[model samples]
Target: MKRVEGRVALVTGAAQGIGLAVAQRLKEEGAIVVMSDLNAAALQEAARRLDADAIVQDVASEQGWIDTMRSIREAHGALHILVNNAGIEGDPSAPKDPQGAPLTDWNKIFTVNSAGVFLACKHAITLMSESGGGSIVNVSSIASLVPTPFLTAYGAAKASVQHLTQSVALHCATSGYRIRCNSVHPGQARTPMLEALFERMARQAGASVEQFTAAFVAQIPMGSLQEPEDVANLVLFLASDEARYITGQAIACDGGYVLAH
Candidate 1:
């Protein structure tokens, strides 16, 4: 109920999926939200629909964060929330050469997933510290905690994000800043990315998408997949004053999927 009222939030990759859900949730809770994404058209449309500010950007670029922070300062006066949610699925389930991936693939994965998060946190801390501190939530994945075949690069990148959150939190604490940093790991959420992944798996296994989904769901003790809103709810809490004392932790909104195996 308006827990984030009067706050200013910037959500990267806000064109769709979990990022879009988080932006909407923050706005609904009364925060002035700025949505950014690489897809300019989609970002514009989403911003129009949600009535939030939009910035088309490649989060991996250093200048992207600079321009974004400048815009935020001009429009919102200060930053209160930064949700680093931009990422890519990286390589396909079966690559051309599974045993030996190209260095390009590895670099691209780390560039967007890990480097983007670092850039956001770096600039966010500067603005947040000036404004009496803020909150930062880095969206990680359950793959970071467990073994993930064919997604080695993605898993490694997310693992770095988890540790990055802890380091940022500790630095802020030691510096006497009120800012908080944490990571959220979601497993098998029903987003477009997951849908495409399921479809790919279905084709590879010679099964229908529904069948593949059902089989996957069976592995989760909760017997269900999470929705983007479910993760967004937790993000809202962490962005709000309710989670003021919480920082430097990796929390899972995985519907018990991570524990099933």
Candidate 2:
């Protein structure tokens, strides 16, 4: 049988980037996927690409989780996997401290990145328990493990996600629920978000984008940056029966960036 044959999965932020890659990987492993994002047009486009059901939702809202679960129940009857991948990098506002970051920026990052994962897990666990258990993969970041200078809020939020995953996993295990929870930490991948950051860094350093990218890559012991699929492959493994024994762990797909740096 296929790795995830007959399974149903819900992936948040599935319109693009890491989420999109995870959804595709899950589908390839034989799971029926349902994806959601705040970007309606992008979600629709991603849906078309995967031929999967897609919903537009603001993941930061409590009602959005309720509605998303309701839709999944009505459409698929039961869900076997939940991938909490929705997050924001916060607004480009000034820092509040000597570094110049703003409080509003921190709030925005926490709301979507940390609180959103909490809400999704809150609802998903309820449903998963009823169905006799499921697997959850919370997409965190390498920032959670290492110190990130400018993106303090983002790092903190992802760190919360890692802790939350462990908390949920321990709860389920102790409470006799079969559900499993884990977090995946990805490093700088070649997504639009990374591109934007690279552009900024390139301009700041008076270098071309390629030059800045090479400089960044030089820090990784692996001598390269990771691709979205690099993270997706790990997610796919976690969602599969092969990972039935794994839970409450934070796996990093950073191409040695954490260690090298």
Candidate 3:
């Protein structure tokens, strides 16, 4: 039998980039994938291509979480995997100083990136518990592990996700649920979000996006931008039985950026 056969997984931010790739990977591994995002049309198109289900969601809201969980429970009858992939990089124009980030900007980052994951975990854990336990893979960033002086808000928000994953793992295990919570930190992937972020940074630096990308890649020991599939493959492993023993960990699929840097 295929690994994850008959399993039901819900991946947020499934309209594009890493979220899209993760949804495709899970479906390929025999999971009944449900892709959700704020973009109804784009998400529906993506889901059609992947042969997965689609739901509209905004992870930062409690009502959004409640509605999504109810939809999954009623439609699929069980939830096995939850990939908390929805998030934003905030504004590239924001101040770099961790403290200098305006409260508004900081709140925006936390609301979507950190609190979104927390809310997803809160709801997903309940469904997973009823389904006899499951796996949750949170998409974080390598910046959480390293200094992200240029994007302090994004960095701190992801760091919070790392800690939240750990906390959820403890709750699930201690409660005798067969659940695992882990974070996957990707570094310098050629995704739309990263492209947009770098484009903004490049503009500020008065350099071409090409130049910025080259400079960024040069810092990675792997000497290249990781494809979205590489990160999705890692999520696949973490969601599978092979990683049954792993939980409460933040794994980096950064092409060695975390270690070499």
Per-model TM-score on C-alpha atoms: 0.96, 0.96, 0.97
lDDT by residue (tens digit), candidate 1, 1-261: 689999899999999999999999999999999999999999999999999999999999999899989999999889999999999977664352346666678788899999999999987898998888989999999989887765777888899999999999999989987899999999988898899888887888899999999999998888899999999999999999999999999999987887865
Model 3, global lDDT: 0.91
C-alpha positional error of residue 170 in candidate 3 after TM-score superposition, expressed in Å: 0.9
Q: What Cα-based lDDT does every candidate model obtain?
A: 0.91, 0.89, 0.91
Q: Give the TM-score of candidate 3.
A: 0.97
lDDT of 2: 0.89
Q: In model 1, what are the clashing residue pairs, if there are any?
A: none
Clashing pairs in 3: none
Worst 10 contiguous positions by lDDT, candidate 2: 91-100
TM-score pick, better of 1 and 3: 3
The alpha-carbon deviation from the true structure for residue 2 of candidate 3, after best TM-score superposition, in angstroms, is 1.9
Candidate 2 deviant stretches above 4 angstroms: 96-98
Error of 1 at 87 (Å): 0.5
**What is the lDDT for 53 in model 1?**
96
lDDT of 2 by residue, 1-261 (tens): 578877889999999999999999888888999999999999999999999999899989999899999999999888889999998887744542327677788888899999999999898888888877889999999989988876788898999999999999999989887899999999997788888778876887799999999988889888887889999999988988789999999999998888865
